[model samples]
Target: MKYFLWLLVSVALAGSISSCRSTKRIQTAISKKDTAAVVPVVDAKADSMRFIHEIYQAIERNRIDFNTFSAKLKVDFSGDEGKKRDFTAVLRIKKDSAIWVSITALLGIEAFRIMVTPDSVKVLNKLDKVIQLRSVSYLQELAKVPFTFQELQALLIGNPVFLDSNIVSYRKNEKTISLLSATDIFKHLLTVSTDDYRLLHSKLDDVDVLRARTCNIVYGDYVNKNALLFPTYRGITVSEKTKVDIVMQFKQVDFNVDLTFPFNIPRNYKRQ
Candidate 1:
């Protein structure tokens, strides 16, 4: 009886080991397969303009799942061709129109903190120990955080704001969504997904300005938990060659929470 029990135990242990190895192998293969599939789908572009519009439609129809989110942003300023600014920001977004962002370099020095709500914009230069609260005017100023003030608000609340303007003679080159801006400053372009409607990438070019006016952005790392495509990652570049990458990973998201804005600046913080 003892000999028989020993044999059974050995066989059981061997089966367990074989099962574990098989599971690991399967998981690795799945990972490779998924990566391969996602790469091409993201690259496909029937027409950048239509893709962007489709993305707008998807977000418009699917904005129901937006709530709250948090992510780390990476900004890079140095590019080989002297075209971009090198900086990275890690951003945490709450659906209440609130955002907390920290910007730094690859070496992790010179950190900047920015916080924005529906009515207030607070920028803190942690390295300088200075803070500024100002009125919202995003169309004029460029940053890795908010594409535009309206978009910032939407991002803070987990909504899509890229749909603010209509498609006025959209253009694309398989990898880009170009929108002719009515304004003199912005030449808009955005990269979108095919299998689903999500803004995969975003970019803007100045019609007449030189050097410092162009921007390129890529959005990825989608987490499809709430029946919507939530961009878990975002990258932005200014000036073309040197890239400022902003990376974000969403953590907590709450939907339909009562959010209010005071827009009141603190009396203590100094104004620039």
Candidate 2:
């Protein structure tokens, strides 16, 4: 139960290869911001190799090129036991630097403040006045995902988080490209838009099959921010021993913006 919010925080915490000639050219087009709302022309007779190239190009095009990002989000969460809650959250990310979040509940009271970096994770429970300082491994244990801070940042920013470069199989349809990979512990499915290569959805299921643990994420509402497309809305669902669903909508978004990360544990606060 103590790990509940970490899973949610991981969502808020905010890949791959090549193909043939035409696909390389398409990447150049995307980087130049020439293809606004342009969907690539899918070849009906394309083979797995060609399709792989196209998929990689699209994935590359969707990568967010930003030094810093800050957003005010409306966060809603629900659980399998019919519990619901809402909080106003401020999310700040410095590319490859850190992710800082402040969650406010009733009357604008800050209930929790968390800061995660490449090396450590810090959480201050304002309600209990307890501070939890943990190593990055603690988070890996809590979430049961072999992810780094960079991976969480990618997830929050609507980018592909964990895609196996050596894909076993893939399916390409009119609107989406789906890639699949199987490991001993988890099976991963990543789906991206056929048009812009923006990630449309991602899912991870426990290989235990009988245990029924999974994490699903969906990205939507792409908005152009200085010629770069970013998702304005995100939905994450994780089902394990406990079920948690989180939805985040960016009310205001800014990029390459000057930001301050303020995290001060109170002097009287006890460390947990």
Candidate 3:
């Protein structure tokens, strides 16, 4: 049951132990030759600032806003030991309030039901008939990094996490733009489409060089619904000592819909 909980939280707080390949690619892209004639240093600096501002604006323009969000998801998880598990999950969230999830295993048997809020974490394990409740800090402990309910909510809803405006550099290709920003906690490299500014990928590394923690996220298969563009698929890779991969495909999704979070522990279940 503890392992199961760890896997769930790890997926929500995705990071990676992967190499710095993406960083190298961005550096290479920035140094690529430009066919356009060179301009004065002052004008070039102005153009760079304008470009950065435009990118920030585009990100804000595409941010998802809602009162409530719900989705049916198909999740595939691969662990470090080469074990794989596939399950279906129903997720519901109230903005800045709560997140509820139900995971079902083979033969439609409900395996776990979880509810997380600003202050606490609760889990009901059907297979073991146990209930585990702990303070919100438990999530941070499980992920080995500071985490918050708001960050988890944003991750599930396809919003960028750990993003900062202190952009140090940017690189652009014909189709995509990559911005690298550094903050106290993370060095975040974010990539978005040139045409619509839809998120394409994100790579994060801990600012402290010795920690050796990294995460990579990819977004794809966007669909327009209710006048909003949403990504239906996400791929996450988190690594430090070991690697864990998670893929989420949204089978159905809706926003600003009335919802309920039902969490009732069975009387006979033992508290762990």
lDDT of each: 0.43, 0.69, 0.74
Decoy 2 TM-score against native: 0.81
Weakest lDDT window of 10 consecutive positions for candidate 2: 13-22
- Of candidate 1, the 10-residue stretch with the lowest lDDT total is 10-19
Model 2 per-residue lDDT tens digits across residues 1-272: 14335654455311111211221222232221211112233333448766676677668766888899999888666766877766788899999889888888699988889888989988899999899998877777767667687778887776777665665567667877877666766667677767668777666666675776666666777789878788887767666677666667786888998999999988999998
Candidates 1 and 3, the one with greater lDDT:
3
Highest TM-score: give the candidate number.
3
Rank by lDDT (best first)? 3, 2, 1
TM of each candidate vs. truth: 0.52, 0.81, 0.85
**Tens digits of per-residue lDDT for model 3, 1-272:** 45545754564542111122232232232211310112112222567878887898899889998899898998777777888877788989999998899988789988989999999999999999999999999988997767878778878888887677887667787887777777777767777889888887777776665766767677777888777788887777776778777677886889998999999999999999
Candidate 1 yields a Cα-based lDDT of 0.43
Model 3: worst 10 consecutive residues (lDDT sum): 31-40
Error of 3 at 207 (Å): 2.7
What are the runs in model 2 whose C-alpha is more than 4 Å off?
1-4, 9-46
Residue-level lDDT of model 1, residues 1-272, one tens digit each, is: 11111111111100010112221222232222222112232333456656556655665675644455544443322233444444554555565557666667458874556666656667765555566766554322434223444465454333433444554445444554333332444545433444454565444554454443444344555666556566544343344334322223344443444543223334565666
